[model samples]
Target: MAEVLFYHLDRQPLDRVLPGLLEKCLERGWRSVVQLGSEERLEAIDAHLWTWREEGFLPHGTSKDGHAAMQPVWLTAGDDNPNEATVRFVADGAGLPDPAGYQRVVMLFDGNDNDAVDRARAAWKEVKAAGHDTTYWQQSDQGRWERKG
Candidate 1:
């Protein structure tokens, strides 16, 4: 089963919403992935996450012998996808389970444009249409999120 977390920005940049989201993912046992949008917000939040990593704010179930916490897997589109160190970070984050095998998957999205929102919804729809246990979500401009069963 794959669960999706959809957010309505309410006219805020992703930076304002991302950190709390990453924290939510950590708390809910969902691996985090960021899309290739908002480079400034992405970079700023990445650095902030790094600071959290150094300050012992990482998640539990990390694999390294002396590792402290788990950091979200930063997935930028095309050129800036995570590097080896980030792969290690993902591994440290809940031991990097194979997503294909994950029975419960939760996706967090910054819902701003219809194109992006539609794209995500379409993907999830395809998966659900294919007979997988899934849920889809979209956030409205009125600052309310709607989930599709």
Candidate 2:
């Protein structure tokens, strides 16, 4: 079964939190796919990953970049997993893909947005019913993640 993690982003925005998570996946030698809710966000994140840090960047590409199999991190607004990623991160209220082939699925939602929180709640139930091991992590006042449930 895949492990599903819900990250409640209240203290920081997605752009600030995502790069670190992607770095963790790289350290574990796991390829990842970041699914966004719109093409605009996909473009924005694709650009951000390249310059998120001053010293180095996460190796990533979008459909326009081609060579999907060569990217360590694939960014897309669709459900396609061209990189055959073991980890999938869904942000901006993107639709969840099937968790069957993935080792882990991370859902990042804005805690301050009621609509986003509601969607995450619904997603939690869905993933639980689908039999995935699920966990919830909320950001503390210090911006550290605390496992809530």
Best by lDDT: 2
Q: What is the C-alpha lDDT profile of model 2 across 42-128, one tens digit per residue? A: 999989999999999889999999999999999999999999999999999897778888999999999899999999999999999
57-146: candidate 1 lDDT, tens digit per residue: 443221222222233454442233232222211211112223344344444444556655565565566656656565544455664556
Per-model clash counts, in order, read 4, 0
Each prediction's TM-score against the native? 0.47, 0.97
- How many angstroms is residue 51 displaced in model 1 relative to the true structure, after the best TM-score fit? 7.2
TM-score of 1: 0.47
lDDT for 46 in candidate 1 is: 53
Task: Provide the lowest-lDDT 10-residue window in model 2.
Answer: 93-102
Q: Model 2: what TM-score?
A: 0.97
Q: Native-vs-model 1 lDDT? A: 0.43
